[model samples]
Structure formats: structure tokens, C-alpha cells
Target: MPYITGERKQGLLLPSSIEDYINPSDPVRAYDAFVDQVDITELGIQTEPNRVGAPEFDPRAMLKLLVYGYSYGVRSSRKLERATHHNLSFIWLTGGLQPDHKTIARFRRDNQAALSNILKACAHVCLKLGLVEGNTLFVDGTKVHANASMKNTWTEKRCLESLKDIDSRIARILSECEQADASEQGNPSLVKMRECLGKQGKLKEKIQGVLKDLQAGQKNATNTTDPESVRLRSNGRLGVGYNCQSVVDDKHGLIVHSDVVQASCDSNQFSLQIEKAQQALGKPCATACADAGYASTEDLKKSLDEGMDVIVPSARQVKDPSSRVKKEHFAYDAKDDCYRCPQGHLLRYIGDHKQTKSRIYAVGDPEQCRQCPLFRRCTNSDQGRRVERLFLEDVRERIEQRYLQADAQAVYRRRKLRVEHPFGHLKQNLGIRSFLLRGLAGVKAEAALAATAFNLVRITTILGPEAFVQRLAA
Candidate 1:
């Protein structure tokens, strides 16, 4: 049998493999092509120095490999390194070379400052691409895992008991060491005693350190590799995780301002996120939407003061009974400037003032409620029902007015579509159920990288690489 050759010509192309049709193009190759154009040495790369004092691989190339690896759910540096050998896209991207896992891990661990700068670069790209426009912005937070376990949380009592046990163990070890020193064959056992004593001493030092921490009012005793990470509650359950906040653009669901927080509640987060959105976009957005988590009187006041529009629902719980009362139930007395309840009793202002800015109209007619059948349904308090109104009742009134408006409802309906996609993709599709990094700073860097990767994915889907690169350059 004769072996047939495709071509007798020099520099001929090899035949395509069956695997070539599995994927139309190598995704890793596309990523590498994107990363090669940017020089990250000026920005600083995080990977370790080359082995045997050899020149390091291109930082941008390594970054492209890491990100593209992560995009396809390859999180472990070791796994990513393995993928480079066999994965065709990865092979093409890395030029058929594999950077070790340690190098990959060190790049992320060491280059905190550079990673932050890179995140900003991606954000700039989004801004230039018009993904982040200063219009409607959605604010929300999600929880990510901390480095510590829920079991490590030590209470004041637990700390005391744990320290006590350490002290007792140290005392026993010291006593044994002294006994060994006095024995007939002391020298041989002396080394063992000394070793035991040294270990005990180290334990004592650890105990003292913890005791001092408790004395200094350190409520959290989490001793993890990342010390800055705090325990935050998510879904009403306590866990060690970071609270990541994002202000997403309503236009393309791209995150504009992203931050990681240790704060458990969204109350204090609103003002900061709004401020970030303003800074990120270089202008306060025309309209900002947040749920009741960001709804506080002070936050609303601050947003309005900054010349930005806000759409936060009334906290519902803070509303006055006066608003709940039917209009027909209130009888106005023109002469005395008083109002009467439906029970035919005059309502007068009590000497006490309600803290809200609105006027307080109290109907303290003890006899009126005593005779009315609705008293039980109205007030459980013996002092009778007190109606306190806000000083700027009109502010809340206006908010309610907007809530009732058709346009506002429509905008609210758009909220889920605008903001939830990124988070859903991040948590479900991306497999980032919990954070692998710990501490506030580390987690912040991690969150930013995640958001950057997410934006890149979106930009890739919306416009091909050609358009995206042009936008980034522009």
C-alpha cells in the first residue's frame, strides 16, 4: 500500500483534527490575543519571580491565561497549569508552555496593588465602551466566604476557658521539667523535658496574646491568614464572609462601582455606594434605585442633597397612623384648629412632640376611646392612640406620591432585569458560591477581578473583540 501525502510543497499546512470542529476557535487563544496588546509591566504583575533567576514570563500573558482559565471554571492554579498542556485553546494561548501552579498562585497572592490598578483599567474600559452611563443605577450586596470557619468564633467565656486550659497544661509541663532536672538520670530525659517546656511556653505566649486581645476589646478573635476579614451575617444567618456591594448600570447590567464590605447591613452602605457611583461616572446619576435595605431618612436626605434623584420605598414601618386613617375618619374643626376622630371626640395636640419633622396631633380623649368599640383594634397602649407626623411630611408624602406613580412602578419593574443578571451569573454560572480569599482588602481585590471578568464576558457577548479593543483604545 502506498502512503498518500497531501502536498509535496514546502511549508505546507497540517490536516485539521476531529477536535478542531468541537470548538470553532480556541477561547484561550482569543484571550491571549487580547492580553498581549496591553503592557502590564508598567501596571505591575503579581506572579512570582522566575525560577533559577531566569527572566519571567510576560505578565500580561500570565494574566490572560489566569483569567481565561477562571472564565471556564478552572480556579485551582494547579488545575489551570494542567489544562494548558492538553486544552487546545489554552495551548495556543500559552504558546504550548506551562507556567507552574506556584507561579500562578503567587501572582494573585503577591500583587494586590497591581490587581487593584488592573480593576480600574477594566472599569475605564467599561466607561469608554458606554456600558456604565450615568442614568439609572441599582444598588445591592451579596455575601462571600471568609477564610475562617464558623467554628473558630470565640466568645468571652470560651476565650477564658481556652486560656485557662493552656495555662494548666503549661504549669504541668514546667513541673515535669523541674522533676526531670532532679532525677538520677536527668540528662537524657532533660532534652525531652526541655522540648515539652518550650512547647508549653509557646502555648502560654499564645494564651497571653489572646488574653491581651480580649482586654483590648477585640470582639472578633478570628486568627486566619487574612486577619482583616470579619464575620458578617447573610440571609439572617451568621457566617464568615465579605459583603460585596455593586452599583450596576441599568442600561447593560454592567457594574459601575463595586466594593467589598464587612458591614452586615445595607443601611450604612447606601451613602458609600451612591458616592462611589458619582465618582465612578464623574457625575451623580439622574436616578438611583434601591430597596428598603438602603432606605433611611438620612440616606435619602444625603442623596437629595448631592443633587441626585432617589427612588426608595417608604420604610412602611415608619409611617404614621394618620396616613393609615381614612380621610373621612378625620373631622376638621375650623374654629379651634383641631380635628375630631370618627368616634365624635375632639383630637388635641399633646405637650409631647414626636421626633419626626411632621406635626403631632394627639387625641388623648380618655373618655372617647373608652366608649368606642374600635379602641381595641386601634390602640393596645393605655395612653390612647398618638398620631405623630413628620416636619417635612411632604418629603415622605412625595416619596409615596412617586411610589404610586405609574412611571416609578415601571422603573422598579426594570430593577430586577438590570441588576440581578450579573449576580446570578456570578454566583450560579461562575461557581463563585463562596470567596476563596479572606480579609477585606483581599476580598475587595477578588470582587473587583470577578466583576472585571464578568464585564469582559459581557463586552465579548455584546460586541466582538474588534469592537471591544477599539473602544478600549478610544
Candidate 2:
């Protein structure tokens, strides 16, 4: 069989207009049209030329480049810079203008506020399309590696030990200088001693700075490279990374809001993220769905107090196997202020659990516990089974009751699919498993860009590029 022949590069003929090469339904058109429609000036992108040295590139054009780069999964400044030179879509998006890598990087780094506006603009389009009216929003986070090395981590223990080592070296250096001045027999020279001492002094300052950060209580450990980042464990592997959070609307899996946090704990982020997500969506989320990781007293109480039904199970409930006896098996009797075990044993309230700030309840007699059938599976203690009810246990219990309903379960089940898809797209399909920027601010901006791209693509898919842009114009 003979292979088919194709036109030579030099002999190839194509449309004169670049727009003719891009399909009408291509997602880049939506990205372009969206940026063009956005009031880049109000979004903080400069519309006028600078009075200084060089005429500035249109912020609108630069905004297009960043959003399109994120949508295309070319996040690095250098990669995006290269894309402008040859990538047909990028060339079409920027109208054949190729900015350098430095310019591309500076544009992204400087326009985080405008990027946020772009995200809000995407959410507005979704709202107009009725994509965010589901009343259920899923909030979750994933660990994305920072532009920092895991080996650059500093702990309190390591910090203290390093300080001690530096102190000793400094002392030795001082002694060497004294000896050199006195005899010149053992020590090399005064200048060498001074240089060694200066080096040790700088090392001591760096370690002490790390020590100060650790003591500030933001994180127990610190990375010298990215100070705001913490040690995060994702997919059973630990690394220096930030917790990237997204509040996804359930209707079409649209990201209503996005943020990046320095803390690894998800429980503390619900109220903060929900407030922002609601702001972006322009309406409150009636029901919030998250996994067991977000079941905290502060969060659950706040959600209930706000009249928003939050569906979240405790980690224990989600992780315990069917064969294992879970905390849920021990039912709480609010009327009696006691707990009923699997064997119908009542564990009465004993005393206040001061350390845990909870009420402790236990079987009065250990001897009665010895007669139980599920004792071995329930507890290994000779003191019988004990349960600690938090001060806000009622809040968690209320959410727990709501979570058992079939409707709530149906909504809750959608959390993984609705929320994880953005991350899956960003990390797997878009090739952004790790962030291209460093520090919390830079990563947050990067996440916003990714989310904006996702929402823009989703809108195009639902409405088609031409249709969405037409709606934008309409």
C-alpha cells in the first residue's frame, strides 16, 4: 500500500484570516470573547499607554494570553511564550503578537486582582446560563506541590539543633581568631577566621528566621523556598505544597469560587470559603456537601447557625469498615444524656473531659463490661467503653441526621464528581499537577486562572463558542 501524499510546507495554501483556521466552536473563541467583554480597566488592567519609556502591551491582550494559557494547560511563562511563536490558537488569540517569557510572567504575577475579576465574570456567565442555581456547592481541596524543594524544609527540632551547631562553630571561629592573633601557630590567618565567623553568623540568622516562623504557629515546619507552604500529604505521598480549594456548583460542576491556603486542614476552611463562594455565585449555597475531612465543630455549627444544611460525615464514619464497630453504632440518647451501645448497654455521663472540652460518658461498672459480647471489638480498655461528646456535639448530631437521608446522600454523592473534576482536569488533562508559581499569592492567582479557564471551557461546551460569545454580546 502507498502512503497518502500531503502538500509541502512551502507549497501549502491556507486562509488569509487567522480566524478562518480556528473552528467556530473552538473554546479559545469563548476565552477571547470573554476577556474582550470584560472591563479590563475596572478589573485593574491598564487600558491606556504608559507615559514612560515603552508603549505598554494591551492588558486586554495580556489577559487573553494568561487565561488562554491556563485553558490550554501551558501555565509556565516560558511555555506560553513559546506557544505565541508557533501555536496557531495562541497566535490567533493574541493576533500574532508574541510577548517574551518575562513579560508573560510579569503579566500573570501583577494582575491577580484582574484574574479574580475574570473568575467572577465566568461565574456570572454560568449564572446567566443557570449553571449555579443547584443550591448545592461542594468545597474541597487538593495538595499541589509548590515551587520549593522538600529538602528545604525546616522543623523546630532541626532549627534548634542547627542553631546550636552554628553557635559552636561561631565560638570555635572566635577562639581560632584569638589564637591566631596570639601565636599564628595553630590558626591559619585572622582574615580566614573572620570570614568563617561571618559565614556562621549568616547561617545562624537564616536558621533563626526559620525558627521564628515555626514559633509563630502558622506551621510546625517551614520550607526555606516557599515560606507560606506547609507539608501536605496527597495520594499517600508527602511534599511541600499548598492546599488548593475550590467551591464547585453542583448543576454543571462550575467553580463558583477558588482559593489557595497555607494550612493543610480542610475543617477550618468551610466558613471562610463558603462566604466567598456565595459572594461569587451571587447567592448563598442552600446545602453544602463535603467529605468527612470538613466535619469540624466550628464549621458544622456555623453552617447550621446560618440555616445552610452541610452534609459531612465524620472521618471515623467514613473510614471504618463494615465489620468494625463504629462510633455511629453507639447511639446517643439526648433525653437521657447517655449513649446506647450495640448490646443495649447505657453508658451514662461520668464527668467533663477537660482536655478535650467534651462530656465523657462511660459504663459505671467495669464488671458489667466484662459480660458484653462486643467488648473486644468495641474497646480494649478494662474501664469499659467511653464516649466523649463535644460541647457542640448537638451541631454535629444535627448534620449527621441530615446526612442519613436519601436525598442528602444523593446530593452528597455528587460532591466527588462535581468537585474533583476541576482538579482532575487541571492536574491530569491540563498537566498542572504541580503549580508553576511560588508562594501563596502566586499559587492562588494560578488557581484562579485555571478555574476561569475551566468555567470558560464549560460554558463553551454547554452553549458552544459562537453561542456563548453571542450571548456575551447580547
Candidate 3:
């Protein structure tokens, strides 16, 4: 049997076309058509006519290259530069123009705002295609590794210790220099010592600046490599990264809103993400579902007040393991504004605890509880059995009641499917586990591009290349 053979170097009589190299159904073609139809001005791409220096490449082409490159998991500027030269699809997308790595990197770095606008534009396109159901959004956050290294991160105490060590070393070196200078003149060791001193001085100045900023309450932890990156606990490991939050629509699992935050916890991000999603969609979200991490009393109350139906489990429901008596065991007497304990003891409401923002309700007589046989099983505190209810506990209770209903639970169950699928695809399929850009702004830009690419792929999947091209034409 003869093995199939192919020509390594064959001369062609007819001229080869970059267009013919790519198929009509190729997603790159769809992306090219999409970019051509969209207004570059809305994407914040610079399109001014250049009369002076060398004529600049069209921003539209550069954006198309980036969107297409990122869609295929080519994130590095060097790799993208290489792709333009070697990859036929990229050649077709860039129209035979190969911008250097520096140009590509600068475009990404300087146009973070533009990249975010592009993400919004992609979401708007999804909305127009009926791919996104703006009425319902599933909100969640994932910890994506930053471009910084955890080894470069320092706590306040570590910085202080480092500064102290630096000061001591400088003092010791200066004393040694003074002693050596008295012993010998114009020594090579003295010159090396002076150089070392200068280096240490500059380092001291940098550390001191960081310390000053930290003392002034500007930052929590400092990372010398990427100052904007925070040291967060992610997936049972400590790392320097950003908390990327996304609001995904339920209809087609399209991302409607996304943001990169420095906070490790997502408790305070619920209202902010919901508001942003509403603004992006130009309408209020009928319902928002999230995990227990976003179940803060303040945020839940604020979301409820804004007429957003928020479905989130309590922190205990998701995290707590102890099988202790639950708050539901206590019966509330609305008429008397008191709680009845399991032993039929009336727990009267004390003064509101302003610091904790809760109404303190405790058994009226501690003596009776102390004498009771069940005291050992119930009262762990010396002050007797007490229950603290949030001032807006009713709002949370109402949500919990609604969540108990079959329909609300069904909607809540869809949260994981709607929100986690995109994250899994980005991390596992596209290799977006860590960001290639440093700082929050750059990370946000990378995330925006990633989301745009994901949305583009999704849109192309829903509408084939020809149909998508027709949509773009329309």
C-alpha cells in the first residue's frame, strides 16, 4: 500500500488569494464582517485622518485583529504578531498588514476604555439578536490570576519589617564605608560600596512611599510587581489576582455586564453588578440570582428597594456545617414585637444595636434561663440566649419565602448553569485562567476582549456565518 504524500514546496501558476484561503463558514469571516459593519467611533477607536508622520494603520483593522486573535486564545502581543505573518486567517483579517508586537501591545494598553465599550457593544448586539434576556441576569464572581506573582506581594507588617532591615543594612554599610575610607583612599571596594548604597537608597525610597500610602489608608496589601493586583484567596489557594464579576443573561447564557474588582469577597458587589446590568440593558432586571457570597443584608435590602427580585441563599445555607438551632425555630409575635423561644419564654426586643445594624432580642429574665435544664444546650453566652435580627431582616425573610416557592427555586437553580458555563469555557477551553496584562485596568481590558470574543463565538453559533453576515448587513 502506498502512503499518501503531499508536496512541501509546490509552485503555483495562479495567484493565491487570502480570501480563498479561509472558508465562507469560518468564524473569522463572521468576525471580519461584524467589525466592518459596526461603527469604529462607538468602539472608541481613533479614526482621524493623519497628514503628518507615517500614516497609521486603520484602528478598525487593528480591532478586528485583536477580537479575532483573542477569540482563538492568542492573547500575547508577540503571538498575535506572529499570527499575522504565519496564520492565513489573521492575514486575511488584517488585510496583509502585520503590525509589530509593540504596536499591538500599545493598542491594548492605551485603549482599555475602548475595549470595555466594545464589550458593551457586543452585549448590545446580543440583545438585538434576542440572545440575551435582559429581564433576568445571573450574577457571579470568579478569581482570575493576575499578571503579578504572589511572591512579590507584601503585607503591611512585612513592608515595615523590610524597611527596618533596609535601614539597618544601610546604617551598617555606611559605618563600614567610613571605617574603610579612613584606612585606604580611592579603593575599588569603596566605589562598589557607594553604588550599593545608591541602589539601596532608591529601594528604601520606594518602600517608604508604599508604606506612606498604606498608612494613609490608600491600600490594603502591596504588590511590587503589579500594584493594582490584590492578594486574594481563590479556589483554596492564595494568589495575587482580581475578582472578575459577570452578569449573565438566562436566555442564551450571554454576558450582559462584567467588571474586574479588587475585593476578594463578593458581598458588596451584588447591587453594583445589578445596577450596571440594568444600565447596560437600558431596563430594570426583573430578577437577579446569585450565590451566598452576595447575600449581604445591606445589598439585599438595596436591591429589593430598587424593585429587583434578588434570589440568593443565606451565608449559613451555603457555608455553615454545624447543626445548631436555626433562627426559624424562634417564633415572632408581631403584635407584641417579641420572640418566643423554644421553652415558651418571651424574648423582648432591646434597644437597637447601631454598630451591628440589628435589633437585639433577648430573654427578658436571664435568671429563668440560667436555672433551666436546657441552658447548657442553648445558652453559650454568659449574657443568656439572645438573637440579633437585622433591621432589614424582613426583606431577607421575604426573599427566603419566595425562594422556597417551586418557581423561584427553579429560577435560582438556573443561576449556576447561566453564570458558571461562561466562566468554565473561558478558563478551560480558552485558557483564560490567568491574565496576561498587569494592573486592574489592563486586566479589565483583557476581560472585556475575552468576553467580546466569547459573545462573538456564541452569536456565530446561534446564527451561522451567512446569517450573521446578513444580520451585520441589516
In terms of lDDT, the best-performing candidate is 3
Candidates in order have lDDT scores of 0.69, 0.84, 0.85
Which residue ranges in model 2 land beyond 4 Å of their true spot? 1-23, 50-52, 168-197, 216-218, 322-326, 329-336, 340-346, 354-356, 365-375
TM-scores, all candidates, are 0.74, 0.88, 0.93
Specify the poorest-scoring 10-residue window by lDDT in model 3. Answer: 317-326
Per-model clash counts, in order, read 8, 0, 0
Kindly list the per-residue Cα lDDT of model 1 for residues 1-474, writing each as its tens digit.
Answer: 999778656695543653442343334434554566555765576455655787876676677776676666676779888987777677666665688889887877776556655555665556766776768888888887776787766555766787788788878877877777677455777787678778867766775676677568656555434456566776688877777888888888887778888666777677778788777677768888877677666557677777766777776733556634443367656578566877766777654454544455666666666567877765655666655555555465566666667887787778778777778888889887676666665667677777767777887778776666555555
- Can you write out model 2's per-residue Cα lDDT over 1-474, one digit (the tens) per residue? 999887666676688998787887777888888888777777777665657678777778888999888887888889989999988989999988889999988888887667666777778777876667848889999888898988899999999998998898898888878878888755647887798889889989988988987898757788898888889888888899988889998888989889988877787788888888888777777888888888887667777789988888877667737665667789898899999888888899999987767999999888777878877888888988888889987777777788889999898888888999999998888988888777777888888889998888787888788988888888
Task: Report residue 362 deviation for candidate 3 (angstroms).
Answer: 3.5
Which tens-of-lDDT digit does each residue in 295-381 have in candidate 3?
Answer: 887888888898887788887666655555556778988899898888788889887999878998998778878877777777776
What is the Cα-based lDDT of residue 303 in candidate 1?
A: 74
Better of 1 and 2 by lDDT: 2
RMSD (Cα, Å) of model 2: 3.2
Clashing pairs in 2: none
Candidate 2, which ten residues in sequence have the lowest lDDT sum? Answer: 317-326
Model 2 residue 249 CA deviation (Å) reads: 1.7
Error of 2 at 118 (Å): 2.2
Q: Which candidate leads the pack in TM-score?
A: 3
